[model samples]
Target chain A: MSLQLLFDALSLGGIYAIAALGIALIFGVMQLVNFAHGQFIACAVFALILPSSQAVAELGLGRLPTPLLIPVILGFGAALALLAEAAVFRPLRNAAPVALMVASFALGVALQNLLLVIYGSRPKAVSLWAGLGHPVQIGGAQVPLLQLLVIGAVALILAGLALMLKHSRIGLEMRAAAQDFGMARLLGVRANRVISGAFALSGALAAVVALVMVAQTGVADVRMGGQIMLIAFIATVLGGMGSLAGAVAAGFAIGAASALLQMALPAEARPFRDAFLYGLVILVLLFRPQGLFAPAGAKPRV
Target chain B: MLSQHTIRRRMAASTPLVLALGLLAFVLLATTMGDRATARMATETLIRVTLVAGFWIFVGNSGVVSFGHAAFACVGAYVSAWLTLKPAMKGTLLPGLPDLIAAADWPALPAVLTGGALAALLALVSGAAILRLSGIAASIATFAFLAMVNTIWANWTPVTGGTSSVVGLDRYVTPWVALGWAVAALIAASLYGLSASGLALRATREDEVAASASGIDRYRHRLLAYVLSAFFCGVGGALMGHFIGVINPDAYYLNLTFLMLAMLVVGGIGSLSGAVAGVLALSLAVEGLVRMEKGVTLGATTFALPAGSQEIIIAAAMILVLIFRPAGLLAGREITLPARWVTGRGTTHNGPATDRRET
Candidate 1:
């Protein structure tokens, strides 16, 4: 039971960590909170199923082999992100953060409603890789093979991301842009290239999250991404707005806390877990408005 | 006999008066001449006006975009429902309510005021902590507060009927009543915007360091606006419940938050006139699109937009507005009387006070 609980926490935390990283990546380069990231995730999920207003979703691209399917979905996410950047965000590049945020929100509204038009509002069941649902004995706990894969995937992705950021030329430019965008540009780092790269990376992460969520729930709902997006948004702030490491850590922490709260609280009180979690979030902001991992220099100059 | 200062003030004041009269005209025309549906839309529009204006009191002045005001509205709606619902109905529907509330019944007006008051009290408590943070952190804190309130309200089943809506509310909110409240909100918002605290808050918004250096207590000023803003939001929520005759937690969550924020931003987030204008423009646009979706007979054929296309189009329009005029349609300027119209001269300078950026 203990191992099962630990696995539950890690798997959930892994999902949130990826989502948080997606949000943190965009915010790092362009100070806008992309509310449309949720829509992107939803779109990716919907991409797996053919466009239909019917209750049972037909497997569209999910019929493709795993290797090809992964690339197609990732490409879809990246292309959508790039299109949004060119159309919606590029013009508002110099606008106030509030304006950019609101514009992103409007874009989200458009995308969500568009999905509703195409797929209908009902939640659709799409069984992808049903074999992964079988349980495997890991120590004392019977964990689903999918959960273990999720944990492994999360670790691999994080490690690969860290190494790429540390070693690659584009990664270094991204870091430079995130730290001081104007200075980096003055020093000859291509602005558009870095920003577009960040968006694409963020979008790919969102696609990964979509795959995990669809596999876990075996259901695809238009509103599925909204809850995760909101939680990821909170995690992004709690981790320090622009800090990738902080966002991932915070996301994992929040997921673990949520799982623990679900276990610890009385049955009647379990439904109010989010209230307690959000209340804790407020308290944390009060104590560290700059976020938990915000560098000392991030403190606003008075 | 009027000094230039007094003249400018009156002209500036005419902005809200003109807006109120325009709303009054709309309400009167809709209720008297239009069908029941049109009248209902007018009332709903006025309620939105009250909400957006109330929202403007904090967001416009403090320059802090908050996602939490909808929670205040949710609380206000529930409070009004608890106060005004038939005692017998309350006993069955909300048995967890205190004896006094469960047993006693009240009229709509007092219940609405009580709702607003309770919401204000909530804002005072929450804003005390939230207003201490600045910029985006403050915005995030407000979002958290909204999430906390939503969870509590959605799960507090016995008292709130859980996710199921509280039905059979008295539909006492007529167009006239809504117009009255909307006008009152407009006046209050205008007064607050021109008040010392409002100016101080705006100063803080423009430059926090300078404002604090000038001995402006940013926290206190922001808190004041927040509480005042909550009062109006509460009133608007109560009115909405009375208008729709149903109260649900889902009604005042992210959708409502974004809707209100969209109106505020699209109208121009800098001024009170912008708030009212945004509400009016968006509501009319939405109503028109909804009608189009219902199909209009044009010549020999019926012309109609696809169902659910209104939201998409409106969202697209909002994005276009942001892209083209990021400051909003009004761009932070009030719709006041022109200088020539007021003073009978072609004076280009419309007093510095007319500019939202200036104190």
Candidate 2:
């Protein structure tokens, strides 16, 4: 029982923690909060659903192997990011911080209403689990194949992100910009391109999480973005608000703890899981105010 | 030069009060007649207007948009309701009080004041922790506070009745009652606007370093104004709760918060008059143009309105206002009157065109 629950927690935490890294990158690059970041998840969910629609079977992709769907999903995620940056964030550049923040909220509301109108406010799935099969029953435990896939994807994404941030030119530019915008500009780095790149990466990450979430639950709803965004926000804040490493760690801790609490508590107490997560964030923020692991000399700015 | 400027300022400032009282009289007489429909219309907006005005007291002063006013209002509503509905204090709901003070049941006016006081207390307590953070951090922390309160309210079933709507209050919100409170809030907000505290607040908001250097205590003043703002907000919440007769915890959540925020932003961030204007405009929009989506004969084109059109209109308005009138209609920088139009108390010369050079 313990092993099965632990595995479930790990898979869920890994996906959330991976997605949160994208959010952390944007915050690190630009001091903007980008409240509309969650909509990427919504867009991803919709994109993935197209392949699984009953119409997809009619169109002949239903019989296609799972390997073909993987590349399509990755492409869909990246596209979602690029589209959002062009449609929303780019226009908000010259405005005051407060105005930009309001724009993020307006963008969020617009996306949500649009999704409801287009998708009809019903839950959907990327595809029917016709060939995915049920949970694999191991000697004394049960591990779902989808859950294992999610874990592997999260691991690969995290490793890829870690390497890219450590070695890539864009990553170095992002770090420089975060350190000092004026200095980065003086150093002849193209700050605007870097910021857009960060937003694109964040959106892609959220899309990946969306795809994982749909596959694991086998259901997607318009409201799913708000839920995931709320958690990602809490995770980011608890992990010191701007550090990618902090966001991932916080996401993993929050996700695992919430899952553990859900299992530990009785049926009547399950709904309190999110409330518990929020409460934990509040407590940490009030007490520490700077997060658990921020270095001693870290400034308040990104 | 300074003395003449002072005299002119004193004379100019009193004009708004006289005009406000006149507007109040007209408004009162305009809505006095009619049945339940008229009564609801007249009284319905008073609380909302009052709440927005209360919000301006802090927001206008600090220049930090707070997302937690709803939580304070929630606290006020719950506290006042619990008090007014107590078995001892409520004559209808609670027929008698404790053995020591069974007849201590208060009336509508005092009960409203009591609600405001409790809200102020809640503000003081919360502000101690909240006001320390500045800008976005402060705003987000308040959101967390709202979430926290919602959690507690949703779970504390025995006290809040938990998720279920609280009902059964005497509907004593006549036009006079609401107008009386609304007038009081407007006066208080306007009064605070011209006060030294207001000066300190504006100074801090407009220029923090300069204000601090000028020997103003920024943090303490901000907190005081916030608490004061919360007091009036509490009154508005109680009035809203009592008038509506049935308010659930969800009613005071983010939706209402957003509406209040929209009201402030649309009116003009730091303008008390603008806040009032915003409430009036929004109320009218929600009631009028928003409903006119079916058909408004615009020349010859009978444009079929799309579904969920109100969101689109409001969102457009918000975007437009942000782009064109970022400081709102009467931002902190109002046109300085030349005093030629001042006749005793009526300085009724509509503010001249915007100062293009100010920015």
Candidate 3:
């Protein structure tokens, strides 16, 4: 009922939407689950949490402005995405989807453990919040100014994404390939390159979300990746795996529902928040099968 | 391809011996581990081996992956847990039940059988609803089934104790008891692997459309394998509950499901010996590796390697097998009673003396 609670829920939704979009972007291209997706979120959070992100904050791009931190995280995410594609996905390009899915899931486990070896499993806090100062009273309610910034940033990213997918050359190639891989191949679309680019973008989105959330929460745990993986998966499933808009929408829906569920139930029922949210996605799947907002499957379901 | 003859000869020389060795190890380990650890390990492995075997039964035969098997395990674990716990709790939580189940106490026997039956019942009911969809939808639907069970167990706390681990069961399992079940599982798995229907299952696994054209009811056979798999999985769960003396909902997580899967793939999908080998080898590797991890903590810093080494090892092993031997370690190939010993019909170069593996 409180404005603070409502805004908090929105911010959480925004964070989830960003992470889900990252997963959806890659999935939208090649239908790979990118099981390592959670690891991407983890990598970004760890990258930001390391003393390096702090050192950056103390100097050049770090202290420049809070807004600039966004791209630093994004760039880091993009690089990781490319590296993952090169190392994990590319090698298995010709393999069956299940085989790839299984391998990537294995990669996800590997990525999580790699973080464990480096960070040693003790939670770390990324000081992205250092400059943000404090909360402000918006109307009669106290709200963190940092959360509003994240929501605004999410809007900007979504707009930029829309532009990229709708108007950019690489995006065009990616879309073409997704629409028809064989035909796209015949038409001179380099399937591997388009998918790799998509992965880079997906990885970037995961980083941006991680930076925002780490700022809000102030702790970067290795398990953050698993949470994102599950949320992104639910969003992907609910949105129809390859549809970005659907993923974004489902992401927001899941986020808001999870946040609200915290208030709606007692402490005992809180852990069931995700369980209920995923269960809703399942029900939607039972009937829609394709997705609630499945672009190609739109007519029949609606 | 290494000429068909070479492949055949290699398979002929290697298969039976490996299968025998693998099966021998599982039995010896189960028996030699003595009562306590054996009961614990054997029960958990039995349940898992059943899950993997069931998965292969459907996944191998139908070539479709079902991600929702944990749902059935949850169904069986909770159903049996509930039925057994219900009798005890009626005198407490469910004071409303009739005095028979309410006031009376039926022993563990009624509970476990009821648990397995209940799990199968849920599967039958759920199968009726979702079995018609094939491929991705089916996979997702099964995932939904797992989510549904997860949600039910979480919300219906009086029965499952929600996300908190379920406890207070009264059975201390012995390895001998679990060994009996393990042997039963092996027999069931071997018999299923060799049955007339086993051939049908294998046929379906090879090519569903072709098998269907040959007049096999693909759905019926898949459903049968799935239910049977659930039955074994349920038995395994009951044994596990008795063995560990505690049951947390988290125990049946997707990661755990994947653990069973990793074992199967690495063991060589579809083969019975492979399933046993996968479970025993991986279980030891995992448990062994976890206990070996080192940990440290400093001011505001608690560092743990966690029990994660085994998972990484299994994952690495799985990727290697998938890359090199995608057909699985054994594929559908059997380790029949070393051909010459069984039939005496064949030739030499592999000669009688050479065939006598011991000499």
Candidate 4:
């Protein structure tokens, strides 16, 4: 039972880590918290299905072979994020943080409703890699292969991101931008390119989340990404807003907490798990307003 | 010359009052001239006005974007439901409610007031802790507060009916009732903005370090505004419940949170006038698009977009407005009597001809 629960925690934690990373990436460069990131995830998931109001989803990209399918969906997600940056965010670049946040919220609303119009409000079944759902035994513990894959994928992505941030030129620029955007710009970082790059990577991360979510749930719903996005957003805050590694750590912490709460709660109290989880979030914030793992200077200098 | 200058200054200062009266007039016109459905729509819009006004009380002055005021509304709605529902019905649907609350069948006005008071008390308690946080951290904390409220309201079935709709509200919130609450909210918000505390809060918003250096207690002002704002939002929530004659926890969640924020942001998040204008403009646009989706007659033919196009179009409009005018359509300026009219009087005041940023 404990082993199974561990896998559940790891799987959920991996998904949340990826989602939080996406949010942290964008927030690092731009102070804007993209409320629309969830919508991007939903859009990527829906991209696999032909637009239909029917309960059963007809494969669009889902029908393609694995190699092509992944790139196409990731590309679509990146393109959508880029479009939003150009059309909505770019114009409001100089606006207050509040205004930028609202613009993102508006963009989220538009994208969500657009999906509603095309795909309808119903949750549609998407059978992608159904075979992966079967349990595989590892040292007397039966866990779903998909859970192991998710755990592995999260580790791989985190390692790759660390390497990129350390070695890649754009990643270096992003790191600099995250520290202080103006200083980076003055130091010859291409502002537009860096911002676009951040959005693209963020969008791609969102797409990966979408793929994982679809594979895990075998369903595509417009509202599916919302709850996860909220969690990821919270994780981003709890991890220290702009810190990628911190976000991952907080994501796992939150997921582990959620898993434990679900396990420990009485049957009747089980549904109130989120309330307890979020209450803990408030408690954490009270003690560490700058987040549990914020970088130096992240604290309010008051 | 002094008298004329005073008149112009008074006009500038009374922007919120004038805006409130204008909304009142609009509400009166809609109720008087339109059908029952339009009156319903007007009532809903006025309720939204109250909510947005309440939102501006905290968000505008403090520059903290809250996604949690709807939780207050949820608390207020359920309080009203607990207070007003029949004892028999409450016993059955909300058996977990304490006997005193379940047995009592208070009138709508007192129930609404009680709801607001209860919500204010909750805010007083929560805001003490929450207001200490700043910026996006505060926002996220509020969101967590909201999620916690939603979870409790969803699961505390005995008292709240869990996720199910709590029916049998009195439907006492007519257009006039809503307008009264809205106007009251506007007046209260306006007065607060002009208050010493409000100015201090705005100072903090503009520059926290400078404000703190100047001896402003940012946390106190934020908490005060938060409590006051929650009071009206609670009232608005009670009105919404009575207006619809039904209440559900889901109704007071993210969708409503974003809607209120959208109205505030699209109208301008900085001023009282922006709050009112945002609600009014967005409500009208939504009404128009909803009508269009229902098909509008155009000359010889009826034309309509798809059924769900209204949400998309409205969202698109909000984005476009933000892109072009990020400060909102009002640009954080109040709707004073035109600058030209004041300038034509040929009297200069102690300040600019038109004081746009009063708050």
What's the interface RMS deviation of candidate 2? Answer: 3.2
Report lDDT per candidate: 0.90, 0.70, 0.67, 0.88
Where is the poorest 10-residue window by lDDT in model 1 chain A? Answer: A293-302
After best superposition, candidate 3 residue B148: deviation in angstroms? 5.3
What residue runs in model 1 are displaced by over 4 Å at the alpha carbon?
Answer: B1-7, B299-301, B337-359
Which is the winner by TM-score between candidate 2 and candidate 3? Answer: 2
- DockQ for all models, in order? 0.70, 0.29, 0.22, 0.67
Of candidates 2 and 1, the better by DockQ: 1
Q: State in Å the error of residue A290, model 1.
A: 1.4
Q: Residue B97 in candidate 1 has what lDDT?
A: 96
Q: Which consecutive 10 residues in model 3 chain A have the weakest lDDT in total?
A: A51-60
Question: How well does candidate 3 score on lDDT at residue A302?
Answer: 14
Candidates sorted on TM-score, descending = 1, 4, 2, 3
Candidate 1 or 2, higher lDDT? 1
Q: Give the per-residue Cα lDDT of candidate 4 at B15.
A: 75
Measured with C-alpha atoms, the lDDT of residue B62 in candidate 2 is: 86
List the candidate numbers ranked by lDDT, top first.
1, 4, 2, 3
Q: What is residue B130's positional error in candidate 1, in angstroms?
A: 2.3
Question: For model 2, how does the per-residue alpha-carbon lDDT over B160-239 read when each residue is reduced to its tens digit?
Answer: 76798778655677667777777787778777877898889889887777888899988798888889999988888888
Model 4 Cα shift for residue A23 (angstroms): 0.3
lDDT of 3: 0.67
- Candidate 2 lDDT over A1-302, as tens digits, reads 98788777888788778767767787777666666667768766766544332322222332345677656666666776666666655666566666666656666666666666555555754454444446887667898887777778888888998788789998788888777767898998897788878877787787678767766666667777766776776677667767788889988888788888888878866656677766666667767766655544454332
The RMSD (Cα, Å) of candidate 4 is 3.5
Task: Point out where model 4 deviates above 4 Å.
Answer: A300-302, B1-13, B299-301, B336-359
Query: Weakest 10 consecutive residues, lDDT, candidate 3 chain B?
Result: B350-359
